[model samples]
Target: MAKNTGGNSLKLKKFLNRDNTVGYVFALPFIIGFLGFTIVPMIVSLYFSFTNYNMISAPQWVGLKNYVRMFTEDNRFVNSVGVTLKYVFISVPLKLIFALIVAFLLTRKSKAVSVYRSVYYIPSLIGGSVAVSLVWKQLFSTKGLINNILHSLGMARISWFGDEHAAVWPLILMAIWQFGSSMIIFAAGLTQIPASYYEAARIDGAGIVKQFFFITLPSLSPVILFNLVMQMITGFMSFTQTYVISNGTGDPNDATNFFALYIYNQAFKYFDMGYASAMAWILLILISLITFIIFKTSSTWVFYENE
Candidate 1:
C-alpha cells in the first residue's frame, strides 16, 4: 500500500508539471507582450508621477507637489474636471435614452429593419475619426451648415464656437449622434425579452405605454445599466469631438476643455510629463469611483431572471 501511494504521488507530480508546461507555453506570448508593453510603461509612469520630468533632463523627485498644485492652484484643472463631469452626466444619459428609443423602434417587425440598423450604426463606426470630427466642426461653425439652415429659415444664427454655453452643445450633440453602439446593445437586450410578456399585457387590456413601462423597461434594466456605464465611461474619456470641434483648444472660455485634452496639453504641449501622469492616475481613480458607485447601486434596479 505504501509503495502504491508513493507511485501515485510521483504520477501526480509529473501530471502537474506537464499541465504547467502546457499552460505556460500557451500563455507565453500574452505574458511577454504585457510585460514589454503594459507593465513596463505603467511602472515607469507611476514612477514619473512622483517626480518632475520635463522630457529634457533627469527626473527630479517632487513627491506630491504636482497633486497639491493640481487641487489648490490649478484653475484650469478644476474647470476641466467640472466640464468633464457635466459632459459625462449630460451626454451619457441623453445618448443612452436616445439609443433606447431607437432600439424600441427597431424592435418592431419590418423587412427594412436591417437596412435601418446598418444606416444608424454606420455613424458610430466612423464618428470618432478626425475626418468625421472635422465634418462636425464645419457643420456647427458660425457660418456652417446649421447656421446656414437657420438663416435660410429666417432664424437667428447661433455661434457654436464663440459662446461658452453653446460651444459644448455641438460636442454633446455630436456625441449623441454616435449612439449606434448603445442602440445595438439595447436592440440585443430588447430581442432577448420574451414576447409572451407583451402579449399577456395586451390580453389584460394594457396600453402601449403601460406595457412598455411594466414589461419592457423592467426586463431591460440590466442592459440599460450596462449601456449607461459604458456610455458614461466613453463620455468621460471623450476627446476627438471636442478637440476637433474646438480646434484642440476647448475654446470660448474653455467650456469644453476635457480632462484628457488637458492631460495631453500638460504632457506634450507644456512638457510636464510628471503632471500629466498624475492627472492620468487621478482620472483613472475618478472613473473607477464612478463605476463603483454605479455597480453598488445596480442591485437596486438591475434584474436577473436567474436570481
Candidate 2:
C-alpha cells in the first residue's frame, strides 16, 4: 500500500510538470476571468431574461413574456431595432470604405506619412468618450460649429436634431469619423501584399484602377472581411454617442434609439431588468447570425495567399 501511494504521487508530479499543464497554468488567469465575468454573467442574464425581476423583488419566472412584450407590446422596441439596423448598415460600409481609402493613400514611404497616420488615429482613441460625444452633440446643435460653417458658405442652417431623418446622420457621421483602427489594419494588410504582384500587373498593361480592382482589392479581401465583421459588431453595439447626443431620450421621436441605448434605458431607467436581458440576448443572437452569414459568404470573395 505504501509503494502504490508513492507511485501515484510520482505520476501526479510528472503530469503536473508536462508542457500542456504549464500552458494551462499560464492560461489560468484568463480562464478564471472569462468564466467569472463572461460566462457566469451570460448564464445569469439568460435566466433573468425569462423572469420578472426588477432588482427589488425576487425574480419570478415568466417564460417568454418579456420577448413577447418586446415584439408586440413595445412600439419603442421595434423602432429601436429599426434605428440600430439603419445605423449599422449605413455607417459600417461607409466607414470601411473611407478607412480603406485613407489607408491606401497613406501607403507611401515617408516620415511625414507616419505622423499623418498618428494624427488620423487620434480621433478613434478619443472618439467614443463622453467628452467627444458631447462635443459632437454641440457641433450638430442649431448654432454649433457645423451650422456656422454652413452659414459662412452661404447655406441655410438646418435642424440636425429636431428632424428625425437628420438626427441619425450626426451619429452616423460620428461612427464614420472613428475609422482609425480599421485604417491601421488595412494599412498593415496593404504592406503585406507582394510588390512583385503590382509590378507584374503593371507589366501586363494594367492601369491604376485595374490594378487596384484586380490586385489590391483581392489581396486585401481577408483583412476587409475581418474589419467588416468587427466594425459591424461595433456599429450594432453603439450606445454612448446616441445616449449622449440624444440626452438619453432617443429623440426626436426615438430616431437615434439604438438597441444598446434602449437596453440601457430598460435596465436602469425603467428598471425592467428582465426586458433588458431579453433585448441583450436578441442583440447577441443577431450579431452572431450576421457574423456567421459573413463568414459563410466570405469563401466566395475572401482570398488567402496560402490557399
Q: Write one digit per residue (lDDT tens) for candidate 1, span 77-193.
A: 999999999888888889888888888888976779978987999989999999999888889888999999999999999998898988888888888899998998989899889
Residues 107-196, model 2: lDDT tens digits: 998999999999989989999899999999889999999999999999999899999989999999998999998999999999999999
The regions of model 1 sitting more than 4 angstroms off are 1-18, 152-154
Backbone clashes (count) for model 2: 0
Candidate 2 off by > 4 Å: 1-13
Worst 10 residues of 1 by lDDT: 241-250
Model 1's TM-score against the true structure:
0.91
Model 1 alpha-carbon miss at residue 88, Å:
1.2
RMSD vs true structure, all candidates: 4.0, 2.2
